[model samples]
Target: MRFKSLKGIQDILPPETYIWQHLEHTSRKVFEKYGYKEIRLPIIESSDVFTRSIGETTDIVEKEMYTFPDKGNRSITLRPEGTAPFVRAFVQHHLYNEPSPQKYYYMGPMFRYERPQAYRYRQFYQIGTEALGTEDPKLDIEVISMLANILKKIGLKKFTTEITSIGCKECRPHYKTALKKALKNKLNDFCEDCNRRYEFNPLRLLDCKVPSCVKARTVAPAIIDFLCAQCTHHFETIKHNLELLNISYVVNPNLVRGLDYYTRTAFEVTSEALGSQKAVAAGGRYDRLVKDFGGPPTPGIGFAIGIERIIPLIKKSIVHDVYPDLFICSLGREASDRGFIMTEQLRNRGLWVEMNYDELSLRSQMRKADRIKAKNVIVLGEDELKKGKILIKDMQNKKETEVALETEEILKAVSNKK
Candidate 1:
């Protein structure tokens, strides 16, 4: 029997990894500029952590979570999303006690049992940020601005920012009641998932992708209209700040995120390139999350971008041309041994160098170097080893020169351009 990788998983091989590296590098730079410190969390956590935070009625908790019984018979699950675990970490480590507003950024794989498609996968990666302990609308504006800048930096031209206000604890009940009344009679025409969501989270029905649900909810009540006094002001303030920064956005009535904790301001950076699954990044205010996770009544907001979805968009939009700095070519046994030492020395100087250790022929080594597109080739053969010298060949200009293996000579030879 031939074993194969399970469905909805992908292998990121060589050339494809260049895109991942670029994305990570750009994310770090942008996140750092916003004063977000990096935080790493465990991939697995208590099942209740997600059930309580992401909401038990959500698909992630209901049918998609990868849960199992560990050795102690404790329920553990691979994280399906990024925010809940970070919230757990924030409370467990007492980060909320020391700081008024703690900002953290993270990037890693999240697992969910779902159907795979072009960009959707069961196991995928996300880059996100969390800001804790601030109800100020400015923080919301900052997060949205930072996400927009990141998309611009990555060269996503066909994207737009959609913002909405999902009301706070004060006004959501009224909105929920109105929504249920509107859909109560038409529930039979909705999908089973939408029918279940109606009682648990009517707002989620707006996010349903089913064509029938979309048509049914087309005239459904929007949460923005029911915002309480405070929520309405906060939402208006977020919009004012965004306009102050000249950040363009469209107010989306149905942009309630998938999670239950979100309140007030919600936003998504969507791309036109990916058809129905066009949301490259989405997040919003989760003011009650910290308190729900056992921390103080702190306000927090964040956004998470799907790395898999963003990478393909970047590849289609950005141009990256990276090549090795030098290639070490070994001709014979003795030369191969010395070449290994020389390779280490070059690497120690903060240069990218490559060489085969299995003692392939000089022609084969040169071919490999060419394949990797190394700029310079350093040939070490029996003759050059006997003479205590090496041949430096510039791959671009096809120029060659012999230099002594002395420290100064080797450094100058490698550093000099052809």
Candidate 2:
């Protein structure tokens, strides 16, 4: 019998995984610097959480989520995104009790049953962050600044951000009414999806890509125009703060994010490397979500970057030249044991070390070290054991050095260069 992975799901193997690890590693570095601790949530959650929070009218809840019933007939679904589950945990743990504004980051796979495309899949990975309990527009600027730094750090050169203000609860109704009125006669001209959108979720009219729908969106009302004084001030202050931070952005009226929870501020970052489906990351403020989820009113904002999309755009060749600090080449029985011991000691000291073992001749052992591009190669043979010394060769310089069998002696020499 033959079996394969389900369609739209692909395995991440070596060379490719090298890039994934690099992105995750660098995310930790940048996120931690911005004071975001990592959070891990269950991959599955109660289905209503998403339907209620994401809005049943949104495509994610209405069409794309992977949901099924358990033996008890309770519906459980694989999370299609990180935010809702993150909030569920926040509410479950009552995180507000610990701090006023808590920031957390996460990296994991997300599931969606949408048609797969370049840099998108039914199952994909995402690196996301959530800053809870703060409504200051300054936090918006900080989050944007953090994303820019992360993008730069990962060597993503072909990307830009588009920012906008989506009217809040106090303001969105005006825009929605105006947008619907503007589309009254043109409702039939919209795509089939937007036809339903007009009746169910008129705000999503701007999200459609069908030519007629897109053209209709061109005439649609802008949320920014309807922002109430408070929302307007919040949006304006964030823009000013962004300018003060020297972060550039484009004002996109049609950039209302796909999520129903977003309010006041919305933004998307796109990459040229990934053609028309260009957004690599997107997020906005959702001040009403905490209360929507049964918690006291709390303001929050965050973003999620598609690993599949970002990896394709990153110039990973420049990320880092990974190599073992040392490679141990052992030829005899006694030498193998000692080499094994030396390997552990070097690793404990935070040095990446590789050793040649099994089915490898001395010549082949050397090749293995070169294959890994180890900086230094230690030759442990019978003669060297009797001599109470080992030979260390620097592959790059083709230089040789000798030291006593004591591990510290080798550590001293290696630590100096590293």
Candidate 3:
């Protein structure tokens, strides 16, 4: 019998894992620059966190979430998205009590039950950030510009920023009424999902990607037009501030968050290289969520970058392959034992070192070292061990420097060369 990974799940192997690390490292630098701290949250939460925050009417709650009952009969779910869980944590921990706008960033896998395709998976990863307790329009612009900076730093040169305001509670009712009236006659032309969304969450109708639904929504009312005075000014300020940062964006009236909690200033950054899965990162404001979760009145905004979606579009020029700094090739049992100690010593000094345990010939071990592209190599055998000295071979220049066999000597040799 054989066991294999479940469907829609993948093992991120070498070279690829290097890219993931690179993306995370680069993202952390940019996030820290914007005064956002890292927050680690659990992968599972009470099902209500999402149902209430993301909306029971949306596809995620109705069709996609990995939900089930635990042994305690409590309904639990693997988080389908980041914001809901984040808000739940904020309220539960009283993070709101500490500051006006607590900023946090998180990176980890997110689970969903959707069918796997190109970049879509049942188990995927996201890099997300949330700014809680503030609704200043300037913060919105800064968040959007920060996303643009991350993409730019990651070498994603071609991406479009689509911004929109999904008017807050005061203005959404009027737009929902207008949108429904415009699409009512053509309900028959829309997909089944859109029809359901029309009655429950009409804003989602504009978000449908089905050909017929897309066509039917052409006449639907734009949410921006219905923005209340406050929301209108908020949206306008986002645009103007973005310009001040020299960031380009498009006001996409059709853009709307699938979640119910989002209020005002929604945006997405997309790349044409992704085809149908175009959005690499997206987020919006959710001002009422903290209060709804039993915390004090607070506002929040955030975005999640689908790591899988962005990985494919990352330019090859920026990603680098990881290789060992030193390969210790051992010939015999005694030499292998010595090489093992030396390898650990080098690694403890913050060097990437590799070695083969099998009693392969010197020629074979050297070949393996070359194949791994080690920066330097050291051969360990009876002859070198007896003399208490070894040759450090520089792989690139093929220069050999003889050094004492002691760990400190080898450490100094590599550290100096590096």
Candidate 4:
């Protein structure tokens, strides 16, 4: 049989990876600015980590997760989403014990067994940030503002922010009761999934994207109306703070997060450029996830950017070519050996460099340099090696300079450009 990548998996090869690198770098910079340090977690986790934290009724547990028995007959799963694993790390490592609010960010692939479409893939990447151990509404505003700032920094400004408060333990039950009551009258009109959601998580029905379910919910009672005094005050304060920051948003009563652990705040950023799969990023506050995962009570909020979705929306010319600072083209046996050592020495000096060891003509080597878009080309011919001098050509400006082949002279010459 011919080998191939799995149906829903694709390689991030070549020029495409330039965009990924830019996105990851931008995310790290932004997250670090907010005091969030990077945390690396295993791609596979004990199945219970998700089942216990993500809830048994959610689609991620029932339908999407890639779970299998391990060598020890223990259930292990490829993480379908980031938050559960992030929380697992927090609780397992006792992060909350170190400080009042533990902040972390991650960038990596997540696996699921779902039908892929548009920007959604079975194996996909995400950039997410989590802030644990705080409940101040200003933090919620900060997260939303950060999302807006990140999208703006990435050149995705033509997007809308949708925000909502789904209430908390004290008040959400009442909203669920009201929503279930209103949905019951029109339950038959919704899709099968809606009916299933009705029986278990009634709040989820409001966020359903199904055409029929969405139409049916037009008459359903809104969750905002059912928010108790405290949640109502909280939502109002969030809106007031958003106004203070001049962050435009629409109050989406149906913006309930897909995760079971989320309480109070939930928000999403969408773009019309992405068509029907409009959401490029989404997240919310999960105030009780720490305690649920065996840690002391902590309040947290975060957001995850769907990297695949963001790639398309990113404007062209934003991700530039990955060009090496120098490419060395050498001819003759002695020149090649000397060129190779010089390549290593230049790299040790922290300059991006590339050199060919093959027996290609100078023209062929230049072609390779052009393919990689090298900024500077160094020509080390037999005579130049014998004379302790080399030829340098700037690919961008079409300028040429000759200098002593010593590392310091070459470094000074190349490093002097604006």
Candidate 5:
């Protein structure tokens, strides 16, 4: 029987894996620089974690989450997003007690049961950060700018940053009422999803991309107009500080995050190069979630960058090639055994070393080394082993340097040449 990978799932193979590593390393560097620590969360959690946090009326809980009952007859789910589980950990561990604003970042797979499109998958990876315990708008600006800096360092161009204030508990109800009143008559013209969203989640109706829904919501009231005095000030502060940082952004009135936990400032970074699945990263503030999850009142903001979405764009901007620093070609069994020991020594000494274990002919081994783009090649045989001397060939320079067969001498030759 021939089995294959499940649908909507993908294997991230190399040189692509190299690109993923590059992205991970770059993100870690940037995140650490901004005083955010890494937090590793599980891929599975109690189903309520998402349903309670993402909202029962939202599309994620209504349709996209992967949920099932465990053997204990308790419902379990593959995490559809990162924030809820992070909040659970935060509350359960009382990380809130540590400092005024506790900042953390996470990177892992997120499961969603939607129809996979280009750059969209059932099991996708996300790099996200959450800063808890403050409602300061400066934190919002810093988060958005940090996201821009990561993309900049990763060599991504041709993207736009969009932001909005969805209003807090103090004023969102008024905006929702006005929106429903405006869209009531036109609800029949919207798609079925939009129609359902209208009754249960009017804010999401504005988020619908269906052409008719999009056109209809244009006539609906903008949430910005309904911002209460406090929310208004918060929005203005975010805008003013972002300008000071020179981070360009557009205030998108219709940009309501898909999650229900979000309140106040919301933002998304999108690339036109990714058609339709344009959002590469998005997030917002969730001021009430900690209290809702049975913890003390706390405020939080975060964003998640889709790894699958940014990889193609990053590839266009950067080419990551993996090559062995040294390839040792062995022509005989005795030479092969010795080459194996040499390879380990060089690797232990902090060099990328490879060797042909299969006792292939000299020409075949050389071909293999060349195919892997090894920087240097050493041909070891009975003659060289007996003579106690070998030649290291520089693949790029096409030059050869003679060195004693001792590991220290080979190390010196390679180190000096490099």
Candidate 6:
């Protein structure tokens, strides 16, 4: 029997990984500019961490999480998302005690058991940021603006920002009742999953992918109609601040996010380039998440971008190649051994170099270098080793010359050309 990887999982092989590296580097630079620090958390956590913070009725808790029992019969789960684990770390590590508003950004894999299509996978990566311990509406505006800036930076031009407020705890119940009444007679026409959502989390019905549910909710009551005085004021302030920053957006009443932790000011960036599953990034304010995780009363707002979705969009829009700087090609056993050392030296100088040490022929090694799109080829033959010099070939210009293999001379040759 041939074994295969589990479905809905993908391996990010070499050539495609260049896109990921670019995205990660850009994300770190933007987050640092906003005064956010990187935080790493466990990929697996106790099951209760998500159930308590993400809400039991949410799809992530009820249907999607990958949970199992350990040797001690305690339930542990591979995290289905990033926010809940970070919140747990925030409280457990006592980060809240040090500052009023702690900003953190994280990028990693999250697991969920769901049908895979297009960019949706059982194990996928996300880039997210969280601002904890602030209730100011300016924080909401900042979070949304940062997300928009990232999308623009990534070269996604034909995208739209859809903004909404799901209302706070005080007024959500009223909207829930109104939403339920609108779907009461037409419940059977919707999918079974949405039928269950009606009883537990009626708001998620707006985000349903089913054609029947979407058509039925066309005239349904929006959450904006039921917002309490405070939530209403906060939503308006977020919009006003967005206007001040010249960020264009459309108010989407039916934009409740999948996670239950979100309280107010939910937003998503969608692109027509990705059909059906159009959302490349989405998030909202979860004001009560910290308190739910046994921390102080801290209000937080943030966003998470689906790396898989964004990478595809970027590939379509951008035209650039990420290639190795140098390819160290060697002949004979002695030259191959010295080639490894030369590769390490070049790498220490912040240059990407590649070489294979299985003692392949000169022609085979050169072919491999070409496949990797190496900019220059450094030939370390027995003759060059004896002379303490090497032949350097500029692959792009098709020029060859002899240069001293010493560190200083090689550095000067490469640096001067650039």
Winning model by lDDT: 5
Tens-digit lDDT track of model 6 for 196-253: 8788778878878788878887867889989999999999999898998999999989
How displaced is residue 149 in candidate 2, in Å? 2.3
Cand. 4 TM to true fold = 0.91
lDDT per residue as tens, model 4, 1-418 = 6998897898888678888888888878888788889999889999999998888988889899999999999999999889998988898888888776778899999999989888889999999999878788888898899889888887775889999988889888887787787777888899987787788888777878889888989988777887888788888999999999999999988887767989899999998888878889999999899889888888899889999999987848475745698999999888899889999999999889899978899999999999989999999987897798887899988899989999888988888862
lDDT of candidate 1 over 15-64, digit per residue (tens): 77878888888889998998899999999999999999998777788899
Error of 1 at 320 (Å): 5.2
Best-performing candidate as measured by TM-score: 5
Candidate closer to the true structure by lDDT (higher is better), 2 or 6: 2
Clashing pairs in 1: none
In model 1, the Cα lDDT at residue 309 comes to 83
State which candidate, 3 or 5, has the greater lDDT: 5
Q: Which is superior by lDDT, 1 or 2?
A: 2
Tens digit per residue, CA lDDT, model 3, 304-387:
999999888874755476688899999888999989988898899899999997889889889999998998999988999999
Work out the TM-score per prediction: 0.91, 0.91, 0.93, 0.91, 0.95, 0.87
- lDDT per residue, candidate 2, 1-418, as tens digits? 4999998999998778888888999989999888899999999999998999998877799899999999999999999999999999998899877677799999999999999888779999999999988899988989988998898888888688999998788888988899889999887788887887687678778877788788867778778888999989999998998888898898888886778899888888997778877989999998989888888899999999999898877745544577898999998788899889989988887888899768479899888889889999988888889999987889999898999887788888887788
Question: Candidate 6 — which residues are off by over 4 angstroms?
Answer: 181-196, 208-215, 317-374, 377-391, 400-407
lDDT of 5 at 20: 91
Full ranking by lDDT: 5, 3, 2, 4, 6, 1
lDDT of 3: 0.90
User: For every model in order, what is the number of clashing pairs?
Assistant: 0, 0, 0, 0, 0, 0
Report the poorest 10 consecutive residues by lDDT, candidate 5: 314-323
Model 3 residue 200 lDDT?
78
Better of 2 and 6 by TM-score: 2
Show where candidate 3 strays beyond 4 Å: 188-192, 210-213, 331-334
